[model samples]
Target: MLRYYGVDLLDHHRGTLSARRVWVLLKHLPRDSAFARELHGEESAWGLGEHLLASVIDHLAIGNWLFTSAHTAEGESPPDPPVPVPRPGVADEEDETPAASAGEQDLAWFFADL
Candidate 1:
C-alpha cells in the first residue's frame, strides 16, 4: 500500500511495527471526502483519541460495529411501567420545558437547516 502511495508506511512512525492499520484498505474505496474522513477517523469516534480500533470498524462498514444512521435516544428509562402517583405532601408544579443553551439551540438549528 505504501509503494502505491510513494512512501514507506513503516517509516511514517519510528519503532512501530504493530501496524495499527484500519480495515478496508484502498481496495474499492471511492475518492469521496466522507469515505476518506470516516476511514481516517477525522470526524468519528466522538473526537476521542485512542480510536484506532474504531477506525477499523468504520472502514469495514459493519452495521453493528460501525455507527448507524438511526435515531437513537441516549437516555434510559425505568424498566417497569410508570406508576402515576404523586408523593405524599407533594404539590403539583407547572410543567415547563428545560431551556436549551445557545450553543445547543444553534447546533439544532444548523442541523435542521442542513
Candidate 2:
C-alpha cells in the first residue's frame, strides 16, 4: 500500500516528506502500545473501521503532497489531464455537480459524532 502511493521506506530521500512521516509513525507504533489500544481496542485487533481510517489517512497525505508539489514545481509544464475532453453532444457525468447523496450525508454524520 505504501509502495502503491510512492512511499519508499528503503530510501529516505525518495518519497515525499509527508508520506515519509506517515511511514515513520506506522513503523514506530507498537502493536500493544497504549495509542494502538486506544485507537482500536484492548486486544488491538484491527476491524473494518481501522482499515478504512488508515486508508483515508494515507490518501490524504498523498493528496497533500500532490498539491504542494504542483505549487512548488518551478517552470515545469503541468501534466496532461487524466480524463479526455468531453464530446460536443455527449453529456459527461463527471462534469456534472452532484448533490450530497444519502450515504455521504450519513458518513458525514458518523464522523461528526466521532
RMSDs, each prediction?
Answer: 20.1, 20.7
Regions of model 1 farther than 4 Å from truth: 1-4, 15-114
Q: Could you say which candidate leads in lDDT?
A: 2
| Per-model TM against the reference | 0.14, 0.28
For 18-102, candidate 2 gives per-residue lDDT tens digits of 5446545644566555545444444345545666776677677667666766886678765542443222223467565433224
Model 1 lDDT per residue over 1-114, tens place: 453444354542554432333122333334333444344333322333335555554555544323343334457332332233322222457645333334433334423422
State how far residue 83 of model 2 sits from its true place (Å): 27
Model 2 residue 13 lDDT score: 48
- Index of the highest-TM-score prediction: 2
Stretches of candidate 2 off by over 4 Å are: 1-44, 73-114
Q: Alpha-carbon error at 75 in model 2, in Å?
A: 7.6
